[model samples]
Target chain A: MAEPCTRWDAEGRLATERGETLDAHFAACPDCLAARAADAALSARLVETGARWQPPGDWEARVFARIAREAPARRFSWWYALFPALAAAGLAVFFFAPRGGGGPGSPDPSGAGFEVQIGVVDGAQVVRSENPKPGDTLRLTARVPTRDPARVAIRIYRDDRTLIFACGGGEVPCSLADDAVRAEVLMTAPGAYRSIILTGAGPLPAPAGTLDADAAAARAAGASVTLGEAVRVW
Target chain B: MTPTEDNPTTPPRASSDPGAAEQAVLALLERDDRRGALTALMRLYGDAIYRHCYGTLLDADLAADVHQTVFVEAWRDLPRFSGRSSFKTWLFAIARHRCLDALKIGRRRRSRFTTDDDAPEPADPARDAETDLAARSMLPPLENCLGGLRAESRTAVLLRFQESMSYEDMGKLTGELAGSLQARVARAMPVLRKCLEAAGVSL
Candidate 1:
């Protein structure tokens, strides 16, 4: 006597056919038909019962409110830092522009002499904060004066002296023209990240070890302005 | 696991347009309206997520906790949602992972506290008819059978039937091959059928 096909075997075959009916097999095999019927009944019952499960009374309100409260704090911290710079720029324009007749070469009234802004690009938008989660990509934009042959490098370091990323070694420095210099850093680990941006007279040396060590090395390279910002990753 | 009694809230509003709902969610999230997007998402998939968590964990409180965690994580990661997968699949994947994590924590707690007296207890037959009726009304007898299967098997069954997910979608969401998921569902069906038959369920 030949062995009958098990339910698993029959179902596997049916699944491969993408819902094509196995009428001929079902017609010949009572056991398979019964099994199919049982499976259908079970599926129907599950869907029916599951459809009846309800969320809490204020589930939408609670979730929306909780996320609203928790999400913005982490997202807006970088923006809060940017706000001061923006306000100072506005103040400089308000306080000094009239005195200088709004001329193009009015001593660069913002007074910082250079502009460096760092954010993370998520989807279509460039977000201010590096979402403490691993795998976030950070975007850095800097505007340097045309006269200075400033070379740019970004170094990201974890709290324990482990180097996360370094760019603009001797071979490939992130050279800044009069326009904005843009670079991206992909965050790989979750911890405290200290990202140092170095604008040097020549090619910035690659970062080594901790932020302090990197800072010391850049200082040795002579006539470099280094800016450090702390990023916390969850 | 002790099953918690169901406390039904208002029934979900039926929407004829899932695409519109998805668009509305993405639009809000894209505009940085996290609250609005989450509110739309909750309206659309909250009950389904709760059911998935409850079915997998078999504990209402834990399910609710995982449900909240899912939304919170979704809101946090909403910016990175690149639309490679549908929002529904993405949300369910998150729900599945949170439930698995909760189950791991539960197992750890159970293992640490296990004693001779902590052996599995038989079902109580002395319960009143009203309680039984309530349980039956809330969940079919087949759910009790589902509770007997391993977590992976039960999840596969639920995702196949309750969620109406294709093997391909389930494979993508779970990072398993489609054939493997099909085999899992195939293996799970017999156990479910046998349990249902033993429970005197008609086919």
Candidate 2:
């Protein structure tokens, strides 16, 4: 056996200090060279063993094609659900802006006695959902005067549109958690700003791509619309 | 053989430093050339990710599925990646979680057996695990020694040597602190050394 090395011991313990000294000694020592070669071989073997189970050669192309197929459909699906609400909110803006929103259980003209507080999830606790950064989960909660499950629709816009996520609208079912109608949307897309919440008892329908009449028609319906704003940082 | 960039259907024979390739992907992202970014990303990381998934799950079919899923999800999440960590770290974070999730499902199916210290981690086949390890390895003794390590220790060692990850990057990928990771690898070396000795292999 070679004489004991000063840096790393005979027991194969590495010195915590004098790293350069060990490196210097290891470079010149034949036995140390052998040990390093063995370690290197071990690493190479691990890699070679892992290579036995490699995935298909065209995996990247397959994933790209899958993404291409899904991207437009995802946006279209969201848009298909959103067009009616856009009209509902547009008309609700004119009608509800004059009457104003309900506060707590007060007898307001809009009949929307629900308390709505929108917040972004910040780790453990939830904070107000205004001025959200991109990649935030926006939790929009609305408590109605009674436990009848309020229909909450939230749309956020920058210029024309940025995000539109609504529950209890069209085919989207209302999330009835804590006896309140709640909708949690994960905002992944960047460049989205401003948010509007619409609360109603029933479905808000629109012909979609129609005129301002849809909004006026929404006013005639018993629904109440509440508008909030979110300035999203890209 | 030198692999051409235009058609990378086959992986390179040797692993490469991904730094320049990662930079290229980032540049494409900056120019908003998502198609180019996708191409660059796949060419750069595709093989590494496949190997990673296969290494963790030890199932070729499952590894392919997860590999595809990671890239598809990467397309969605890459925009908001925030640049806080290297792209590989982000990608491997996704792979690690996917593999562990698969293992959890497998474990549940096998009656929720807890892995004790020194108990060989199951390589799926209950009877021929040793045979499987040996057959896959160029050095059967070294492979057996590696397989004998705890799952986390094995992962740590592989990421350090095979994947060429710094302890800090490994920490970011695995959500463990870097010092603990250092201690872990340091602790693992002696075990590996002792193991080879027990197997009558010269170090």
Candidate 3:
């Protein structure tokens, strides 16, 4: 008498990894044959179902229009005059400012003043301002002071406010005590990119959607810094 | 009815020489003729990409958004494409990620609302019926059955059967072990069969 086939045997049969034992079992076993037939029928149905879908005729045009509207900006060589002042202020805050006791309404208890600098990593040096090509890698470095180990979140967005990348949204939010935090972002296209840094006594909200909304949410949460920079690729 | 059923004049498969077409697009992109390259790329893979997106996302609007994002990201990242993988694979990877992101957003919204009543409604049935009538399609039952599936299972089934992908290719695209993917597909089949049966599908 042939032994009854197990589900694994049926799986083997489905995978076409049939052995003599399974072949003999299926030859004698009505149940196994039925199961195999059911599986095949299901697979066929799924394939047929998948084939039935057809995107609209103008789907390509719609896609093209969307990309046209949302695509990253092309390389722009004109440096924004405001960035130099902002960079200078950031440097001054990082270097000369005194650490006061945690201020009223400040999220950080250690009175850690936050500063973020966006730059392109040149060979062995971080350049504060440079026209990065499309494929260049940019570095975001932040100095955050914390009392206890705290959470830090960073979100980068394109000019259109679409999310580029986000960290600190999941189980392992970025942790920092009192040091500089750095993340590398690959430049995908030439665009005005914004980086928002959030550090708080608790988990920070993950940024989604446009830049204005993200900034507003981060500000509402009480501890965040937003920085914007432009890149050109040609 | 599928496109093959209704359309007597489907465009001949874009070209016999996909490699040549890909190369020409890449050349245009490299030369900064982004608009021209994009148009060419669209003509080459637009329908297939849209279908993949629609299958994965299960919503035409979301799929369209993901479709756009894939190309926008592709344009940005084209320079970084090492050509280690085929262009189709790379484009599909982007589409998958964008779809996943959209799913995450949808999940977040659903979770935040906290009530079943607050969940998004299905597409307007009247509009869908009109579209279906015009297209002479009968996929709504299948769509309903697919909607009943766990997202992972649905994705596995779509990638395997609809995309006609090998287990190895599916594993690469999904970042799962091939054996695990095989198991997932195996588990998904029975559930899908049951769902379809319950939905009164002949299968």
Which window of 10 residues has the lowest lDDT sum in candidate 3 chain B? Answer: B116-125
Per-residue accuracy of model 2 over B1-86 as CA lDDT, tens digit each: 11234434332222366676677677777877665666666666777888777666655677798888778767766665566667
Residues A1-234 of candidate 1: C-alpha lDDT, one tens digit per residue: 777667534563446336655556666676666666667777788888787766677665566567668765764545323223433443211111112132444333344444556676787687646244567776655443332223545566765277766654433334332344445677786455566655555656665576655665665575243334455443
Measure candidate 3: CA RMSD. Answer: 10.9
Off by over 4 Å in 2: A1-20, A23-37, A47-53, A68-73, A76-234, B1-19, B112-145, B193-203
Cα lDDT tens digits for candidate 3, A1-234? 876556633364446521224446566667667667776787787677666666677655665566556544334312222234344554222211123344543234343455555556666676534335556666665554443323555677764356777655342333232455456777786455656555554555566476556654554565444344333221
The candidate that achieves the highest lDDT relative to the unseen native structure: 1
Query: Cα deviation in Å at residue A21, candidate 2?
Result: 3.8
- Candidate 3 residue pairs that clash: A75-A232, B1-B137
Query: lDDT per residue, candidate 3, B1-203, as tens digits?
Result: 33233323223236778778778767766776655665666667776677778877778777777787777766656655666666776677667666765664565444344433222222233543354344323447666666656667778778777777777776667667877777777777767666667777765
- The TM-score of candidate 3 is 0.60
Instruction: Find the candidate with the highest DockQ and give its number.
Output: 3
Highest-TM-score candidate:
3
Clashing pairs in 1: A132-A233, A132-A234
lDDT of each: 0.61, 0.55, 0.58
Give the worst 10-residue stretch by lDDT in candidate 1 chain A: A91-100
lDDT of 1 by residue, B1-203 (tens): 10011212222232678777787778777777665666567778888889889889776777888898888877766776767677888788778767866774564344334342222211122332333344444555677777767788889888888887888988866767877887787777778788788888886
